[model samples]
Target chain A: MLQNFIFNYIDCPGIQSKNAGKVSTCAGCPNQSVCSLSSTKLANPEIVLVHKRLSLVKYKIIILSGKGGVGKSTITSLISRTIASENENKNVAILDIDICGPSQPRVLGALGEQVHQSASGWSPVYIEDNLSLMSIGFLLNNSSDAIIWRGPKKNGIIKQFLSEVDWGSLDYLILDTPPGTSDEHMSAATYLKEADITGAIIVTTPQEVALIDVRKEIDFCKKVNIPILGLIENMNIFICPKCKNSAEIFPALTGGAKQMSEDLNVELLGCLPLDPLLARCCDEGKNALIEIPNSPAILILKTIVQSNNFQLYIFLFSVSSLYKFNNINYLKLYQEYF
Target chain B: MLESVKHVFLVLSGKGGVGKSTVSSQVALALKESGFKVGLLDIDLCGPSIPYLLDLEVEDVHQSSEGWVPVFADSEQKLAVMSIGFLLKNRNDSIVWRGPKKTSMIKQFLTDVVWQDIDYLIIDTPPGTSDEHITVMENLRNVKCDGAIVITTPQAVSVDDVLKEITFCRKTGIPIVGIVENMSGFVCPSCSECTNIFSSNGGVSLSEMVNVPFITKVPIDPTIGKLELRGHSILKMYPDSEMSKAFSKIVLEITKSKEA
Candidate 1:
């Protein structure tokens, strides 16, 4: 069923598909399987396998906020649904790195679904036809249970999510990070150094208090050389339905989303208006994108997806080199054999 | 030559829950009382409790064309204070800054703010030698530094860590004036005898081993906790308290050492 879905939905170029089969030999190769293929040999076979593995995957864009209650996970879900809906062929994967606040599964309404794992690796539970979902919440015995882990333990779990999880041929992998520039963000950023970070999307409210800290998060990403793709202002404005007019729920202060992006030299992606229904959908474990399709929050995500296409393309091409392999022409071989 | 401005002294500890901030605040307050212009800068970005300790309100942060101005607790005290906690919208709001942001803010707090012609600036640094600590140490190196006071408890772990902290200061060319042992001993609630709760004399022994001056041991007192919980600095709350007396002695030692 999964293979049929992949074949029908994912558009695999013929040359790439042929090359992938040639690189599949590394699955049986002992050295390439255990250690990184880079350590074993510089041969085309190793390169092909590595490339194939990476190409079959997509660029992982992790949205991280320096602190909590910043609506980071909600933004993650919005981006996932938006990108998935925009590109029908692309498989959008959402991995919630907030082990303690595992809300992705719940937000996507995939809570209580068992994450199936085998000798191969752990597989993400499907949210929709095009979106695959995984979170620390899914593997737990109980969803409400807390994850009491130190830095090293969290790092190990993150590693498993990246290398061990069977995220086959993804277009974009969105990781929703827990708040604070602490253990989780550091671990994810450091571990996935090689993975093309389509970039970080910093979420902040219009209030000076949130911006002060959000500015810090922006500076951190800059220091680490992680491209600040954009700054998103969540809860920028509120519109009253009866009045048919929009009002600034939080008073617009200086050094807000626009000022911050200008000062920091990052793109101001867009702002999300204050929508109670959008919040309610998230609270009710429904996709905010589907629940509030006509909402401005969805519009902002759609714009980000459109603007970040160039980056997404470059990320995909870079990972494509990992899968190229030499193959003998079977038709010619068959004629020669005959 | 006439001294234009008194040098800044930053008191830091290598571990948490060591009363480093408490000591720095009191020392600053004491210097203010001694007729010197003093400024207390709290660089503990995440857990900034300086405002609460000094009993200053948020509206006290005066702003000018120059930038945000530090607040003053008392006119006679003449102490200018600034904390990230004060800049925050709410008191309980957590500061979730990355290393670079913390560094930037620290730099701004030092250079951008209109500190005026202050005599002594006592900086309270967060525990551990993380990026924030490094930023304070590095920036202060460029500035005029009088000396640094290393604080610790009478426990071996804290003593060992503080010695390494002292070594760090020494390596960075920051002069170590002295060491103060906080919670050195617990004064009996019933009897007048002092109990060696954390094993007394560790501060003296460590100071002797490191060849730095052993300032004084601030005994554990129930009133200290009460005053602290009330966001009151010990110097302001209990002017004649034993801890205040010990801190004043240390301040005297620092001034005498600097003069020499």
Candidate 2:
């Protein structure tokens, strides 16, 4: 939409230019047809800039869930932490797009980290040597103060995050979106049109109620052409520490994530049991993936990250880099990480 | 917009998934069971869980000469239930609505729905004090709300957010009915043992600090969770359950305050 405005602002060559032998600048411009006011307009300049900025990132994986409080943010944190830990030298960034409820800053222990804006762009707060984050939470003066902006304003901030933030050459740009297939989701897909969106990972609780909504989230991804990497069932069960036995907290009383995935023909990524330690870790701003390395849920997340398609893509990326740089070290690095 | 309803109770919470919808559903059901004509409006635009919490199917809203007809729940009491969930064509079709669209939908839910004369209208709102809260408060400015019932768990994380909800209510001039600390303890299903899962007394201390009444602490009943997943209200299934009694007591406190 912004592209049309920029396209129209360019002065169009009139009939005089047509008669003359001179070639107008508009004639050579890639967006000439769009500038001519054709219905099939050119890509918005802002979106193009967003794509250029995001193309530096290897994968843009969005964490989405239709139901709120379904652990989307936790999954985003877990995945990023796991990847950043494994690929120690690789750059990883998380763009917390949950404008209304930006939990990433506090969850990552980067709360109150001021975002520094330079001539290039806004610099994301580094949570680790290789991992950084950008969130609306950092922009707010007070954590308690609510962001009451409407759809347009929220979209603008998301756009600014995509185009303005200098996330230089990230291996993974994990986008933690708000619940529901609403404004934030739409903006992410629209603005990151040219970015390599590896796909979406839909998170849900192991309850029929949450599964129903998560099914819609998967459907939304299909409609928007954002491939669903898989469905994750969070709070699948509660394991009693004393008895060492698993208990059903919010189970699939009436056809949960497993059944829902079967019915919808989507892959069930894994079920994460309700771990009290994990909750405590998140509340205390600790990394569960690192703190609880043997966590069954974290193991499952690692498996999802090492799926065939993801591995193949990473392999190909390393191979390509090796060829481009005429170096074998990149391949060795990838092999070592894998 | 809701002249026929004598009282309005806007149930809210600052944190999501703290059983605000559950409280709203049970409170409405308890009031209806108490022989009051009730209408439950699920105004949670993005995640409309009232229908699911009540085990409602994807039913269509019929239009009559009066207005859009609220769905009649198959219950003994006269209860009118409406939710944005019902308007969806498919279960997985997400409502990608924005602020203006959500505001208009809320306006329609308030103005266009034919909620017949009722003793109480229980409005279920989404979590947080954002656009939805502001819209509901502004729209119901002329139609006075009896008060708002804030729901929260016993975790400091949740209580922190609920405190914001209390502050928002104070600033907006909405009367604070009380705060209900839900999921205060886990009532062991196998053994009747109570365990403080997320810590206790967070809600009570918060209410004391804010000078508002602490309504009741609803323990995390595993049966209640299962029943909700199965789309059945624990009140109707297990009327004498502790959770049901807690909801009934909260409803009594709300109605009694109205009489006072």
Best by DockQ: 2
TM-score of 2: 0.86
* Per-residue alpha-carbon lDDT of candidate 1 for residues B1-260, written as tens digits (9 for 90 to 100): 00334687888766454678678777887777777888888887765657766767454566789777888767654788888877877653555455667778888887766677777888897655555666777787667787888888765535644665676677668888888988776444434455554556778988998898888989866465343333444666677879878887878976786677
Q: Candidate 2: lDDT of B237?
A: 80
Candidate 1 residue runs with Cα over 4 Å from true position: A1-55, A307-338, B1-260
Judged by DockQ cut-offs, the docking class of candidate 2 is: acceptable
TM-score of chain A of each: 0.74, 0.80
Give candidate 1's error at residue B13 in angstroms: 28
Worst 10 residues of 1 chain A by lDDT: A322-331
> How high is the DockQ of candidate 2?
0.41
Task: Please give, for residues A26-82, the per-residue lDDT of candidate 2 as tens digits.
Answer: 655555555455434456778888988887677778889887777887889988988
Q: TM-scores of the models, in the given order?
A: 0.49, 0.86
lDDT of 1 by residue, A40-148 (tens): 3233343333334445455657786654445687788887887788789988898887654465765677768988888768888998788988888678775423354
